[model samples]
Target: MRALIALGGNAMTGPDGSAAPEAQDVAVAAAMEHVADLVAAGVDVVLTHGNGPQVGNLLVKNELAASVVPPVPLDWCGAQTQATIGFLIMDSLERALAVRGVRRQVATVVTRTRVDSEDPGFSRPSKPIGRYLPENEAKVLVEHGESWERRGDKGWRRVVASPEPLEILDAPAIIELAKAGYVVVGAGGGGVPVVRDADGTLRGVEAVVDKDLAAT
Candidate 1:
């Protein structure tokens, strides 16, 4: 049977965790080892992952170096995490299959998810993202047009409206890869949010998509 796996962010935050990219690759390997079991059992697996922690890390870096370099928008951050996590996962999946004497290719595609431009979430902006910050720090981001929302009892976090994913822009590529017997990893971080123009052209929006909602 073919399986579409929605891998969560926990895989990247494993016990051996460090912020280093190499460490991330190791984490990905660890996660893939479990998936390897299914592959050994004749399952064709496709992976989509979460970037909650990874994107938060990038935001911290951007905040720390705001004066030195331009800050990356939320949508761009999502894309970066997609590529970053996809790289490690794809490499690790390749090794996992090889160890089982299963020779199959793995591919990662940077995916886009379409949402309605009139989404009410855009005005409300209530999806928590990036690192949780103290109230004072959140005020700083708010001053610059980034707002905070209550995150349970912990603290406030930057929130972006997580609109529904209407379509996956990379569906064709993902379908083709899976049909060709490759383990396809796509739609990370829900997908970089895109909105369709009146003329039907799509452009990246400054928001993050919920990973699970995209899977739905």
Candidate 2:
């Protein structure tokens, strides 16, 4: 049977709390070990993943790059994060399969998901970015019109609205790719969270969509 796997952000996270390329490679390697089990069973697996950390890193990159170039928007950042992590997962999985003398095709597609333009999330701006903060710091963030929630002993972190995914804008393409026997990786960062314009053109939205909810 063919299966779509939505990998959690923590899956690619390093134990050292660093998501550096080396660390991510270590983490992705471990993740593929598990996926290899399914592949060994002859299951065709398509992978999707979350970018809760990767996107935050990308935001920092945007901030740092702002002095040199126009800061990339969150939608574009999300797309980039997917491309990065998707490949990490894809390449590792394919390598594991090959080492075991199995031949399988693995591909990562930058996916876009459509959301309602009128989504209330735009006004709320609840999705938290960056690091966690203490109560006082969180209060300051709240004053700035952001949301924060407690994160165990690490203090509070921002919480964003993470709206439900209405539709996978490229679901048909993904299905086609999968049918062609490729282990497709699509729908990262919940597929770029897009909206429909009045002219029927799809535009990227500013809000994040929950990847797990979208995968479901």
Candidate 3:
């Protein structure tokens, strides 16, 4: 049997909500223990993961360095986190398989998902991201025409549009890899949202896609 495991961003964060690189490595290693067990039991595995914390961190860096460097767009942020987290998973999983004497190849795909240009989610902008900010800082961002919303009682956070994922552009490659007995990791952060232009060229968009839907 084949299984697609969908890991949330929390999987890569410490219990105290820390997303430090070492913390993420430990978290991913723990998670891969179970995946290795599944593989040992003869299950083909495909992995997809969320990037909320990771991408949020990237956005914070972008904002802090905006004066000295061009800020990466949302789609690029997704792509970056996909690769970063994918590497963590691949490394940890490989070690786990090695210990268990399970011979398997692992790979990560830089995936892209197509979304409708007219998706209403683009206008609403409701997906919360980044570290929560105090009311004063939130106000500053709002004043600068950025969307901020209160998430429970933690604080305010930046919200971006979460468009629906219509298609995963790398689905074919992912399936082929999985069928060839390789453990495949793909579709991180909903595959880096993109839309087709009038001439059928694809371009990245400044929006996030729901990872759960994209994995399905």
Candidate 4:
């Protein structure tokens, strides 16, 4: 039997929403206990995980450092967190399996999900991200043509387009790895949202994809 495990971003963070490396390591180690059991029981497993918290933190960092360094784009932030979270999952899972005397190859793919360039989601940015900013800060960003939305008593946050995922470009590779008796991890943060150009080139977009939808 084969199973695909989709872990939420919270699974790798502290209960209080900390994304520190040590906190992530502990969280991933705990989650991998179950995954190791599945692998040990002869189940092929493929893993996908959310990066909401991690990527949000990255965006906050981008904003905090904008004057010192170029701010990373949303797509790039997704890619960064994918790799960061993937490393934590892969390493912890390997240790978990080893503890059970199970030997298996583990790998993570830097995946991409395609979306239509004309998706209506682009015109209406609705996915909120990063730490909420003070009214003054939020207004400053809005004045610069960025989308900011208020959430209840919380301050304001940036909102980005969240389009449906059309394809997991690395699905074949992920499947092949799982079939070859490897524990595969892929499609982190809905696979770094991208769109194909008319000239056949693919470009990353400043959008988010629902990780659950992409996992499906």
Candidate 5:
């Protein structure tokens, strides 16, 4: 049987809510122990993971370095986490499989999801992201045209529209990889949200997608 595992963003964080890279790698290594067992049982496994915290952290880093370097866009942050988490999974899975005497190929696909440009979610911007900020910082972001929402007890955070995912641009690659008996990781953070222009070309938007929906 074929199986697909959806790893939540929390899976990459520490038990105490820390998201440091070392903590995340430790978390992923633990998760892979379970995954290797599944593969050893003869189940074909594919993985999808969340990057909400990772992307938010990346955005925070971008903000801190803004004076000396340009800040990265939100969609780009998603892409960064995709590569980071994917690499982590690939390396760990390879080692886990090796230790279990299981041989399998691994690959990471940069995934994209299509959302209508006219989706009402875009106008509303309700999905919370990035680091929480104080009133002054949040106000500064709001004044600069970013969407910020005040949490009831958690200060304020940047928000973005989360439109429904209509299509996966990399489904073909994922299927082919899985069918070839290779474990694949893709659709990180539900894929970097994108919109196709009238010319049928794709362009990324500033949003993080839910990885569960992306995996489905």
Candidate 6:
């Protein structure tokens, strides 16, 4: 049987509520133990992950460093985090497979997901992102055209329109990879949401997608 495992950032959370690299490694290693057992039982695995927290922190870093360097766009930021985290997951899983005497090729695909251009979310950004900010800071950003929303007792956070995923642009490739007995990792950060322009060319949008919802 084939399996698609959707991993979340919380899966890598440390005891102190942080998801540092070391923490992620430990967490992934533990997950690998379970996955290895499944592989031994003859299940082909396809792993997709959500890097919301990591990508949010990355955006915050870029924003904080804007004065010293130009801030990267959200699409680029998403791609960067996917590559970074995908590598860690692929490598860790590969090592686990190796220790279990299973030989499998692991690949990370830079995937894109299509969303409707007219998605209502565009007009009303509600997807929380980046780090939490003080109410005053959030107010300033919102006043300057950024979107912010309250997070219960925590401060507000920047939000972007999270549209529904229309299609996985790389689904065929992912399926082929899984059929070939390779562990494929893709769809990180909701697959770098994009839309085809009138010219039939693809361009990324300034929004994120829900990984779990998109995965379906």
Give the winner by TM-score. Answer: 4
Tens digit of per-residue lDDT, candidate 1, span 1-216:
988888777668756545567667777888899998898898989899998878878989876665566677888899999998888887888888898998988899999999999999988887676777777766666666666786877888887888888999898999998999888999998999999999989998878787898987
TM-score of each: 0.88, 0.84, 0.89, 0.93, 0.92, 0.88
lDDT of each: 0.84, 0.79, 0.88, 0.89, 0.86, 0.81
lDDT of 4 by residue, 1-216 (tens): 888899999888987878888888899999999999999999989999999889878877877765466667888999998888888888999999999999998999999999999999999999788888887777766655568888779888899999999999999999898888889999998899999999999999999999989999
In model 5, which regions exceed 4 Å deviation? 139-145, 150-155
User: Model 6: clashing residue pairs?
Assistant: none
The backbone clash count of each candidate, in order, is 0, 3, 0, 0, 0, 0
Poorest 10 consecutive residues by lDDT, candidate 3: 62-71
lDDT (tens digit, per residue) of candidate 6 on 1-216: 888888887776666757677887788778877877787778988888888768867777765665466666677878887888888878888888889898887889989999999999998988777888778756655654567789988888888988999999998998898888788888887799898999999998789888988788
Report the C-alpha lDDT of model 3 over 8-81, residue by residue, as the tens digit.
99888987889999899999999999999999999999999999889878978866665566667788898999
At residue 91, candidate 4 shows an lDDT of 91
* Colliding pairs, model 4: none
- RMSD of each candidate relative to the true structure: 2.5, 4.2, 2.7, 1.8, 1.8, 2.5
The 10-residue segment with the lowest total lDDT in model 6: 137-146
> Which stretches of model 6 miss by more than 4 angstroms?
134-156
Ranking by TM-score: 4, 5, 3, 6, 1, 2
| Candidate 2 Cα outliers beyond 4 Å, as residue runs | 132-161
Q: Provide the global lDDT of candidate 4 against the true structure.
A: 0.89
Error of 6 at 201 (Å): 0.9
